[model samples]
Target chain A: MLTYEPDETVAHALDPRAKLAFQVAFAVAAISRPALAPLGVLSLLALGVLLSANLSPPRVLFGYRYPFGILCLSVLIAAVTIGPPWIDLADGVRTAHAAYGVGLVLLVSAAYVRSTPVRHSRAAIQSLVPGTPGRLLGIGVSLVFRFVPVLRRDIGTIRDAMAARLGTERSATERAVVLSSRGLTRAFVRADRLSVALQARCFAWNPTLPPLSFARADGLVLLLSVVLVTVPLW
Target chain B: MSTDHEYDSVALVPESIVRPFARAALLAALTGAVAFVSIPIPFSPAPLTLQVLFVFLAGLYLGPVWGSVSLLLYLTAGGAGAPIFAGGHAGIGHLFGKTGGFLWSYPIAAFVIGALVHGRTGFGFGSIDPTADETPSGGFFDSLEVRDPATVGLGRLVVALSVGTLIVYAIGAGYAMWLLSLSPVEAVAQFVAPFVIGEVLKMAATIALVRDGRYELS
Candidate 1:
């Protein structure tokens, strides 16, 4: 689940913390108290937020096709299985509303964070958490982004090694075994080697923390967030 | 928490003050990457992925504290907008979505798996071992620890993996029902039933690695 892709969108212009808060408020509003008009408004509002951030509505919907599709299928199944030879209207509405909520969440979240840098996320995290715990957390998140590509490559290598050793005719289960074993062993060994590298560099926690500077726009977003939260409660 | 002479990962790996934290960060990353290895099923929304393997492995290798610590880091990273969740999805949105229950349970599940691996505490019902001991069979913080997993009887590994899978499903499917407003049968159909065979296969694969003595990370 990697989303951050560099872009000069309006969402990207806001502080990472503000984006985080906006997404949180939006999700909370969606799940905590879901209703008809409010959900529709939230949906429109999410679309507006995405558009303002330079994301296309159709594109976001297309991106969410997988989950939305399954949600539709399940609702249909429920209607068919439990209904008396027909679709149940109430069940259908309820499921549709829930699916809407889910879709809104995925779209807004993907749009907001997809444009930001992994470093910005690290900075946002550091800002929320303070002192030693935050410091450690910031570093760990950095490592996750750093290694995702490395691990992806390692997985590819594992697949290649498996094909070479076990031949292509092996079952998916056999491939998974070798892939997991070899891939994880490589990851762990690399982790240990990282420790050695840390020792070699004499790394310390006092290394410069990622810089996070909140802006006036962020304050406005937070103020707007109050209304966002209140709407669901209202 | 204790930086003692025991095989605390921090002391032995890099020998430093903040190295444990570094290792924790690395483990979280590893878990995130493991999450990306998703295999979609034709029928169920929940896919067959190796996510649980790593989560349990995190517990097996990182011990209770660090294993839980790494999972916490993973949630934070994903929550803060990293695409660390399944299907490369990100943000706190997942924390409240259909899969929210599963995402929320990861840390607790990992901690349980790790604790059982260490025999530090009982998860529920029966303890990890019928006759409990202060220290577990071998190694501190193992991904099915090299020595112990390689040597331990198959029954014990099955018990450990079974307990871990059940914990994940209980919270995962429970929340899935509540969050998604599905009936009990529907919830089970979506979250548990489809994944049963795949989960078992993944578990068997992990155990096969253990039995084959391929456990490398000490």
Candidate 2:
């Protein structure tokens, strides 16, 4: 669900730091506004940003369906109450506002993650927060992003293998247990070897990580982030 | 081909700094990856998530410091927009939203679980040999036997898991109540009650894994 693309677009071109700043800006703007007006503005802005990033709207919206469904369900759940006052329709409206805020926030993050390479993101974190723990955390995060897709694929393979073995006849509990045991064991093995390999290379607390270079566009993106953040606070 | 050692994921290597960090990193990544394994129930807002299985295992395997450290890394990475959270959601915004309590309590729950499973002294890299702690003529304190982690053993693993689950529920339900502006009873009813069965199943899975993988769950 969270796949990255290798491309050269405006969204890809922006510094990861600026994109991170934009995410905070978008969150504030979306959360601070109570009315639907902000969502409309947000939707239009998200569209423009997506276009700049050269990402397809239909695919993005497709990815959103599941979360959108969950949001709708939450709105329904939040609306329910017993006895006097019956149902709180206003709560549903408020939840919807929050959902829109979350959606916009997600969109900004999606753009940044989809476009930026794991190495670039790592470099951004290392540069932003220098030192040993910061370097480890940044490298660790990059490692996770790199491995997520592989693990997701493993789940798919396990599900198919189970299905082939007539797993459909088994109870949900059985399936959960089998899948978890398999997945966790595999993860454990991979982690073990990875650590050995890292050790073989002589892991250093301050090993050289990728470098981050701020460009002219980064300045523009930073300025835009400042404007985006300031408008909501003001 | 080699026999995959159980608990190799958390075994303390001698004189190595980065091995533990790498292992913790992978475990943290595993936690994030599996968090999306959600099972829907007809009546509950909280779908059954596999997060606890990983979280509990981290503590039971790595002990408190590294286990807690790994979970915090997961949270930090997820907060930094890594899509390493449940439902593929990322960013700092979820820190205060609907799932706030459950999400916020993860590192602490992991810590508590580790503390219970691996006693405080056991948290050291390797098991402290009782004899090593004991001096030639007399012990550091001759009266007290050199009881180290080997004494803790696996008998109480289930109990530790149960306590950790409660910790998560207590904090989660409390936060959910506040966020929803509901009474304590209502919060328990709404947020905590529905997921009890799922949690039991998860605990059972962890127990089976621990028993099979290695005797030392800590």
Candidate 3:
């Protein structure tokens, strides 16, 4: 449920491209160097990112509870053995260390998600990858953003209608078929209308898009990303 | 009202591309929408979801190229913060997280399913009109025709979906094993064993949808 919110925070003002680069660098660094001291430093950087975006650590942690839980369970699984020594403490610790590194990477990504808008991300993608393929992806992504809610509503209505007709009594496969069949039909109908609308409005391969430019702060962010990527080398 | 004033500057997307592109985007959105509809299994820690069903249908409906394209769009949108990942988690992190293998396998699984079902590449839109045998014109729109999913034999459909399912599990478990430092046995125990029943059920549902023929691309 953590999504981009309109805010005047530092992370929000930075260029999405810079944030994306920083995230990739952070993940690489965290994964490549999973030692305790390096992980501790990365954790602090992740905290800085979360704070800059005005995201609460507890809230982000709660959002990712399921994956985190699985990570924790893996540690236990790593420890268990069937031999005389019954448990491998070193293996458990190693697994936990890797999981912690992954956790920090997730935290950095949560900040990016909280601060960057879909339009900004789309613009960044279009500018990052040039030509017709980029244009298709940019426009295609925007269309997806525009339609997920509408289709979600359609699915909801279908589910409700099925429930009203005592469709819950049916087998699981029967219910799934009914729901998906109705969902696909509605989606195809909507797509047909949407295609007509696009043609009517003269959907072009090259249209003027909202501009995005990297400011001075983004330069510093990019520098930080570069430094993070070089941490393993050092 | 000059007929030639800047009209040529606007390169409009042709109708042939527009229709499939719209359907692809919508299908991607539908994939996201259905992630919210999870059905909890009795003993398994992971719940069964319709995400895979949509992936299968994506291939069966859109053919290889567009089917993969649709899934690529879904992954990008989710990575950019759509609350569409399992349990509504989003961000680029999920793309590289422990379950990232499964997320990454989607497009490939869809592509495999589509290729096996359609029996040819090129989006399965290569003018399959049996009545008209004029070596169909080569333009984008002229050679295009939406093939009916029902036209595919049942055995092919089942085989395609089974292979798709195997690819998903293979990649998913392989990646998890590497990332989580689990033994292969542990990975299968954790990732693959629990979901067998749900996968079969989803395959059945997808097969039924194709057989029903109610949602033809045309």
Best by DockQ: 3
Task: Answer with 1 or 2, whichever has the higher DockQ.
Answer: 1
Which candidate has the highest TM-score of all? 3
lDDT string, candidate 3, A103-142, tens digits:
8888899999989999999988888877767777888888
Per-residue error (Å), model 3, residue B49: 0.5
Ranking by DockQ: 3, 1, 2
Error of 2 at A127 (Å): 1.5
Q: What DockQ do the predictions score, one after another?
A: 0.30, 0.21, 0.47
Question: For model 3, what is the alpha-carbon lDDT of residue A165?
Answer: 93
Candidate 2 residues A1-234, lDDT tens each? 555678878888777887777767766676565356656877788778777777777777677666557555566666766776878888766656665666666566667657777677777777777555566678788777767667767766887899899985775556666777677667767777788777676554445555566899888877877776665655
| Best-to-worst ranking by TM-score | 3, 1, 2
Better of 1 and 2 by lDDT: 1
Question: What is residue A82's positional error in candidate 1, in angstroms?
Answer: 4.0
Query: How high is the lDDT of residue B22 in model 2?
Result: 62
- Model 3 lDDT tens row, B72-175: 99998888888778877789998888888999999999999888887643443444322133343454344434467788899989999999999999999898
Stretches of candidate 2 exceeding 4 Å from the true structure: A33-43, A149-178, A227-234, B1-15, B35-48, B76-84, B87-101, B122-159, B166-194, B212-218
Judged by lDDT against the true structure, how good is candidate 1? 0.69
